[model samples]
Structures are given as structure tokens and as C-alpha cells.
Target: MSDALEKAEQAAREAATDTAAVQIALAALELAKAAQQQPAPQHHQCDHQHKPRRSAGEWIGIACAVCVGGAGIAFASLALAILGGTAAIVVLVLRSMWTDVQKRR
Candidate 1:
């Protein structure tokens, strides 16, 4: 009975070791196959489409500059008109004052 028991124990240990080795080999094979199946990485390419890049921010800045320049011109013209009107009023007041003083003399 002892001999039978020892033989059974040895057989189970051998089977377990064999199973472990088979699983290791299968895992290594699957890893190798996966590495082979992967596609190679391509180099970064600069195409014609990527060369002429104009972002929306740049366009917005250009438009803003144009609008501000137009506004500045309009404001300057308005300021000039106001100055001219003030000057005309001053000249008229001075002429009337001088004429009245001459008539009283």
C-alpha cells in the first residue's frame, strides 16, 4: 500500500510540472505571435496640407485691427469738427464785442 501511494504522489507531481511547462511555452508563443502581428510605427510626415496653417485666432486679430483703424479715423474726424465749431463761435463773439465798443466811443 505504501508503494502504491508513493507512485501516485510522484505521478501527480510530474503531471503538475508538465502542465506548468506547457502553460509557460504557450504563453511565450502567444507573446511572440502578438509581437509579430503588430504593425510597424510610421515616421511623422509633414504634408502640404499641414504647411499652410492659418488659425482662427490670427484671422480674428487681423479683423480686429482693421475695425479699430476705421473707428480711430471716424473719431478723429468727429473731433476735428467739434474743434472747428468751437473756433467759429469764439471768432464770432470777439467780432461782436469789438464792434459794440467802437460804436459806443
Candidate 2:
């Protein structure tokens, strides 16, 4: 009789703890949703590096390609080169997105 009562009491305690934790998680989600409805703060970072959207690596690559490849490729073939660059960029971006989706699982 005592063993049965002890097991029941332990299971009841666990159930209560689980319920409390779920309530806490729900409350946190509600708070997050409410916060999102409000406007963001204006006292944001004003740094020059943060303002420009593009990263330094991207800018450097673009500059180098323009300086080096721009001379060799002319106006007639520029469109073809741009098409090739666009295709390469698209492949890289899609590959990254696919990897990210896989990692989520």
C-alpha cells in the first residue's frame, strides 16, 4: 500500500511540474507576441560599418571583379558575363538555403 501511494504521489508531482513549465512557456510566447506589436526603439547603433547593408567581403569581391574582369570583358560580352555571374550567385545562394533547411531537421 505504501509503495503504491509513493508512486502515485511522485507521478502527481511530476505532472504538476510539467504543467507549470508549459504555462511558463506559454506566457513567454504571449509576451514575445505583445512586444512585437510595439514599435522598435530609435536609439539604434549609428556606426558607419553597420549602416551599409553589404559585407566587406562582398564589396571587395565586387571591386576586384570590376577592376580585373571589367577590362577584359567588353560591352558586347558584358551581358553574357553578367548572366554567368548571376547564375553562379544563384547557385551559391540556393545551395546555402538548402543546407540551412537540412540543418533545421
Candidate 3:
């Protein structure tokens, strides 16, 4: 009789442990489902895309670059003009020399 009573007590303890495990599994499943659900969006916020604002230092850097580029273009134009003037002067001197040679002939 005592052996039978001990076996019954062990069965009851095992049942209690299984019940607790089942409850924990159900709770974990509920938590997982809740985590998978997405939150609702608020209606008050605007969805328009925005450009990032430039800093003052960045604007100053851009201005400096533009000024330098313009100065470089101006110098290039001046160099071309000097080259053209030199070529014209050479042509005029060569024409005068040809005329002098023709008179000697």
C-alpha cells in the first residue's frame, strides 16, 4: 500500500510540472504573435520628402569654388587673346619681308 501511495504522489508532481510547462509555452506563443504584429501609423504626421539643409561652411566652400573656376576661365581667355595677337604680329612681319624681297628681284 505504501508503494502505491508513493507512485501516486510522483504522478501528481509530474502532472503539475507538465501544466506549468504548457502554460509557459502558451505565454511565449502569445508574446511571439504580438511581436509579429505591426503598429498603426499616426494620421497627424506629413509624409513629404525633404532635402537636407546645407551648413554655412559648406555654402562658403561652394562660393569659393565658383569664384576660383571663374578666375581660371578668365585667365584662359586672356591667354588665347595673347596667342592670337602674337600670331598676327608674326604674319605682318613676314608679309613685309616678302614685299621687300619682291622689290629687290
Using TM-score as the measure, the top candidate is: 3
Number of clashing residue pairs in every model? 0, 0, 0
lDDT of 1: 0.97
Model 1 has a clash total of 0
lDDT of 1 by residue, 5-24 (tens): 99999999999999999999
Please give me the total number of clashing residue pairs in predicted model 3: 0
Could you give candidate 2's per-residue lDDT for residues 31-90 as a string of tens digits? 999999999888867666656599999999999999777676676498888899999999
- Tens digit of per-residue lDDT, candidate 3, span 1-105: 999999999999999999999999999999999877967665787689788999999999999999999999999999999999999999999999999999999
* Model 2 ranges off by over 4 Å: 42-105
Order candidates by lDDT, high to low.
1, 3, 2
lDDT of 2: 0.92
- TM-scores, each model vs. reference: 0.45, 0.38, 0.49
TM-score of 1: 0.45
Worst 10 residues of 2 by lDDT: 43-52
For candidate 3, the per-residue lDDT at 105 reads: 100
